[model samples]
Target: MASIAVYSVKGGVGKTTLAVNLAWCAATISRRETLLWDLDPANGSGFLLGVEAKKKRAAQSVFTADEAPEKLIRKTAFDNLSLLPADESIRTLGRQLGSIGKKKRLAKLTETLAKDYDRIIFDCPPVLNELSAQVMRAADLVIVPLPPSPLSARAFETVVEEVKGSGRKHPPILPVLSMLDMRRTLHKQAREANPKWPAIPLASAIEQCAVTQQPVGAIAPRSAGARAFAQLWTAIERKLAAKK
Candidate 1:
């Protein structure tokens, strides 16, 4: 199974949104057995999937014992898609990881679930802490979401540097521009400015995660956001296919 982590050095760049939509697209459209692992403390991906994991069982349980992640793997409302929802307790995952001698604990944990899944998508947090390091080591491909802002560009570069310096078997980093509103003058300028940028157009449907409580592709298959997600998924698929 191929593991992909959607991450960023900065927050609010639509990392969780990309994780949710891409996993949904892979499962529903590509017919792949996919698992979305929510590693963010905010648990926004869980909220989008209509699962309440805030006060309940935390992702911390997974590290405490061998069965926590297995038990936490909950099937979503969508077919061929499953979720390892995040609990606020995951905020302490960095501390927990530091206590263990296993440098690749996350990678080993994913191995046990490999047989049951075809693709594992991690909705990673936005820092370079121990937890992020573990996720980076576990991922076969790292998908970094960036905004159109100059600051986002810098943050993207920082993530690239961190991955390069990690000393682990790093994966290919795919950078995507998220939440791009082409209607804005700055957005238009950014696009024209970076002519070779691999971007998906921004749309309101992408933000409907809060209201619809579902991934964009599932709720509005014909929406512009859904079409862009489909195209992004195709590109990702091509990359993975070429690697094989």
Candidate 2:
């Protein structure tokens, strides 16, 4: 299975939105068995997909080898899609992983899940630490979502360095602009400067993801936000295929 991580050191960039929506597209549209793994303590992926964690701090067990991930993975309402939800217990994961000193432990666990899932989408935490290092080692492609701002550009650069400095061959990164409003001059200029970078326009459908707890694609398939996600998923598929 191919592991795709929707990650960014900067938070509030719609990272979780991209992760959940793309996983939905992969499962519902591409017909791939997808696992949306929530590595963030906030549990955004689980909340968005309407899956609840059965036990507190259960997610960290997988990383610690105390419990098999398969036992903790919960099926979502969507077909061919499942979730390994996270909880507050993950807050100490960086320290725990550092103590273990098995850099590839997460990668090995991902390999074990390959027998079941065709794709694993990680909703990563917004932090610079050992957890990020582990994700860098496991992911095949990294998707970094940025907004139309100078800070976002710097965050993009930091993400690039973080991925490359993982002490291994780095994964390819695709930077996407999120919450873009073409009416704004800043957004327009950002888009013009990097025409190749996919942008998700500001839309109510996407914002409602928190309230509706469903991907924009599942709620409004023809909406601009949904279309953007579909197109992005296509690009991700191409990147993974080329890697193979």
Candidate 3:
């Protein structure tokens, strides 16, 4: 299975939204058996999917060799899609993972789930810690969402440096421009500076997903937000294909 992580060192960059919508596209559009794993302690991904942030066991269970991740998997309303929700216990995940003393434990966990899933997407926390390091080690592709700002650009540089410092073969990073407000001069300038970067426009339709508790593709398939996510997923597929 292809393990894709929607992550950024900086928060509030639409990382959870991208992860939820992309997993929806993978399950509904591409018809892949997809697992959306929420690694953030806040559990925004499960909330977006209308699933509560409750897990079957303690946070440590996820990294423990004796525990089976399947037991924690919760089926979503959509077919071919499942969610591994996060809980309050995960607030201490960085410590939990550090105590395991295994850098590649998360990668090994994904390997065990590969037989059951065609694609695994992680909605990761916005932190550079042991947990983040573990996710980077496991992911085949790391999708970094950046808002239109110089700080975002600098954050991307930091992400690149972190991957380089991992001391292992790292996954390819795809920088996506999220929440792009075309009317703003700064946003326009940012887009022009990185024309090749795929962008998700800041629109009411995209924000409506929070109220509707569904993906844009499911709620407003013809909308620009949905089209952007669809196109993004297509690009992701092409990148994964080329990697193989």
Candidate 4:
């Protein structure tokens, strides 16, 4: 199974949205048994899928021998898609990872789940802590969403530098230009500068996913936002194929 992480050093770049929609695409479009693992403390991924995390135990239990991670897996309304929801308890994940002292704990966990899933997407929190390190170690591909801004560009550079400094087997990083507003001159310039980068336009339909509590593809399959996500997923598939 291939593990993909939607991560960013900076927040509010639509990381969770990408993770949710991509997971949906993988499941519905590609017909893969996909798992969306929400590592963000806010649990936005779960919220989007209309699944609340039934946290019967602490977050650490997922990594411990006491509880099997499968026990926490919750089926979503969509077929071939399941969600491993996150809770507020995940805020302490960095500390817990540090205490475990296992550099590839997350990797190992994903490996165990590989038997059941064709694709596992991690909706990671925006932090450069031990948890992020573990995520890098685990992921086959890291998808970074950058909004059209100079600061976002700088943040992407920081993420690249941090990944290089991690000194682990590096995963292929796909930088996507998200929340693109073509009307903005700067956004147009940014897109023109990086013609190869996939972009998700800033559309009301994309934002409405939160209110609809569904992926854009499911809510409005023919909408621009949904098409953008589909194209992004197609690009991701090509990248993964080329890697193999």
For all predicted structures, in order, the TM-scores are 0.94, 0.98, 0.96, 0.97
Candidate 1: segments with Cα more than 4 A from true spot? 54-57
- Index of the highest-lDDT prediction: 2
With a 3 Å backbone cut-off (N, CA, C), the pairs that clash in candidate 2 are: none
Misplaced by over 4 Å in model 4 are none
Q: Ten-residue segment with the worst summed lDDT in candidate 3?
A: 52-61
> Candidate 4 at 225: error in angstroms?
0.7
**Tens-digit lDDT string for candidate 4 (1-244):** 8999999999999999999999999999999999999999888998999998667435567875567889889999999999998887778889887988877888999999999999999999999899999898888889999999999999999888867766666888999999999999999999999999999999999999999999999989999999999999999999999999
lDDT of each: 0.84, 0.93, 0.90, 0.91
| Cα lDDT of model 3 by residue, 55-103, tens digit | 4445457786555788778888899999988877777778877987888
Query: lDDT of candidate 2?
Result: 0.93
lDDT of 1: 0.84
Cα error, candidate 2, residue 22 (Å): 0.4
Cα lDDT tens digits, model 2, 71-138, are 98999999999999999999999989999899888899999999999999999999999999999999
The better-scoring model by lDDT among 3 and 4 is 4
lDDT per residue, candidate 1, 1-244, as tens digits? 8889998989888888899999998899888899999988888888888976533756887876745576778888999999888877888788888888667888988998998899999999887888888887888888888788889989988999878766756788888877778888887887887766567677778788779989888778899889988988888888888878
Predicted structure with the largest TM-score when compared to the true one: 2
Span of ten consecutive residues with least summed lDDT in model 1: 51-60
